[model samples]
Target: MFLGDASTLLSVLNRRLPELGLVRYVCTETSWIESVLFWTDIRVGTSEIVLLQSNITVNYIKRKSDYVHEPISRTGLESIWRKMIELEILAMAFNPYEGMMAKISPTATPFPYRADNLWKIQSYVEDTRYGEKYFDGNFERSVEIKTRVGSGNFFRNEHSFPVKPYFNGQISKIASF
Candidate 1:
């Protein structure tokens, strides 16, 4: 999943698009800094130079980031998203090898979502500038379900689910199986 300046939005996109491919890069909007805070904190000296620098004192309210200074408008944002889809540059939210999609991870690690449900990354490959190569896993995943009784919702109570390692790259060693 490609992300932008908004981490909040990036998280949401990732969550919603778990089926997407690798999260390689991020396209951010604008970058912000504590310019106002920094400018406001500056103290002018009583020396002669103070007068010369007075003209340079910034308003402190508005400042721009060095790398990204412009904020794309909502319309522009939508346009960019549309363009990305048109270009087929974006896939979907990242499904870590341990969570939903394990068959794609290089490590061939099997992720357990529940006591009986499990997912394993059979195999995968990526085409990098260097070259296409195999991928691996380094995570674990599990899902828990709980039930409780209350006033508005009275019934029984239950909770269970603990993450545990289940699969390793045994498939990796085998060239073909």
Candidate 2:
């Protein structure tokens, strides 16, 4: 999975996205875009436009603390926000008391979040195909990662992330090869 940002990746997905129907798997906490649209308070407007650009256009919207929504669960969350192709997706991660981050109250004055809009998740799936997630948006490619970062961070050059590879003790195994 080449990870970059949202817009950059969505552009690619729009270019030649795979053809597949789906079922969705997602955590209750993975309701980021939900708050943005449904919450009204977090809706994208003039000021919030930068948030959209950062979260989607740049692809920095991988996680709340600069992580990807893959390693935690296999919830097919993307399907929720946008009209997906009806593929079976599994989305996992923290909805609340499980993960490192905490869900913020909509009315909190100094809204604490890593990004302009916080959409935190660990992992998700599409049908049987899986996406082992992480917090940083470092997928197999740059375009996908960039789309989440959005245009604001992209233009301002603030789009960057530290990715902790899920080594799974393979490092020592690879040395023997």
Candidate 3:
């Protein structure tokens, strides 16, 4: 459930409280919701918790999501279908931001690209070992091309803490997540 570098955490804990004998232990890769559910089950002495833990498997995935302001035309849909067929990847579109999403104020959340969105288009491209050269392998390139063709320009706002330029004279955005 610890969503960070385990070694860094261990080092800090060891420096602060060496007497506690805190050694790093690797936990199964579970989502935050799953971890909370498992913890609750364990706390209540649920009999099926052990079985659930045994079934946990770490999934490696690459996902790109973008909001659409307008509905896609028939030709646009055809283009997307053709691209998916050519690349052998999957793309899905859904409208989950109609009712409640529209009601919420834009300033209410850090996610600024929520309001006035018609639907969301998501692409799932797995980063596999064998296919690491073309198609889904080059995730950034593939996404850039596909998104440009489908939804004009992708709008991914950089949400990072501003930092001074490095010794190499290149400014880097430190990810605060």
Find the candidate with the highest lDDT and give its number.
3
What TM-score against the true fold does each predicted structure earn?
Answer: 0.17, 0.18, 0.39
How many collisions per candidate? 15, 76, 0
TM-score, structure 1 vs. true: 0.17
lDDT comparing candidate 2 with the true structure: 0.33
lDDT of 1 by residue, 97-174 (tens): 223343344444463332222322221111121121222221111111111112222122222221111112111111
- Point out the higher-scoring one by lDDT: 1 or 3: 3
Considering summed lDDT, which 10 consecutive residues are worst modelled in model 2?
Answer: 168-177
User: Best candidate per TM-score, number?
Assistant: 3
RMSD of 3: 20.2
lDDT tens digits, residue span 1-177, model 2: 223344554555556654432112321222445544433333433355566575331122233233432342335444442322233222233333211334444366464543333354443222112231543433434434443333245435433431211222111100000
Off by over 4 Å in 1: 1-66, 91-177
C-alpha RMSD between model 2 and the true structure: 20.3
